[model samples]
Target: MKQKIRDILAKHGGLPTPVDQLADDADLYAAGLSSFASVQVMLGIEDAFDVEFPDNRKSFQSIDAITKAVSGLVGSTEAAE
Candidate 1:
C-alpha cells in the first residue's frame, strides 16, 4: 500500500526529494509536500484505490493520513462483503 502511494506520487510529480526514502509514518507535508500537490495526490489515491472520499473525511490531507483513511475504507468494504 505504501508502494502504491509512492507510485501515485511519482507518476504525478516524479521524485519529491528523497524523503519518500523514509517510512510511511513520515510526515509527507513536512517532507516537501505542497498544498496544491496534495490535492492531485489525493485524486490519484482515490483512482488507485477505487474509494470515494467522503466530505467528512477531508481531514485526511496527508499521505499518512490518507493511508489510514484508505485502510479504513478497505476494512469497511470487506466487512460489507
Candidate 2:
C-alpha cells in the first residue's frame, strides 16, 4: 500500500526525492506539490487503489491525511470481504 502511494506521488508529484523518504505528515504543498499536481495525485491514488474517491477526498490537507484516508478505505474494504 505504501509502495503504491509512493509510486503515485512520484509519478504525479514530480518530487525531487524518492516518495518514501518523505514524511507522511509533511505538507505536500510546502514540499513542492502544486495545485494541479494534487489533482493528479488524487487521480493516481484512485486508479492505484481502485477506489473511487468521493468529494470528501478534496478536503485532505497533507500526505498524512491522504494516507489515513486510504488506509481506512483499505481497511473497510478488507472488513467488508
lDDT of each: 0.64, 0.73
For 3-62, candidate 1 gives per-residue lDDT tens digits of 687778766633366645756666666666666666677788778888777754343444
lDDT of 2 by residue, 1-81 (tens): 656676788899877666777887777777788788878988898887777667663434666687677877767654232
Please give the lDDT score for candidate 1. 0.64
Instruction: Report clash pairs, candidate 2.
Output: none
- Model 2 stretches astray by more than 4 angstroms: 56-60, 76-81
**Model 1 regions more than 4 Å off:** 13-15, 55-63, 76-81
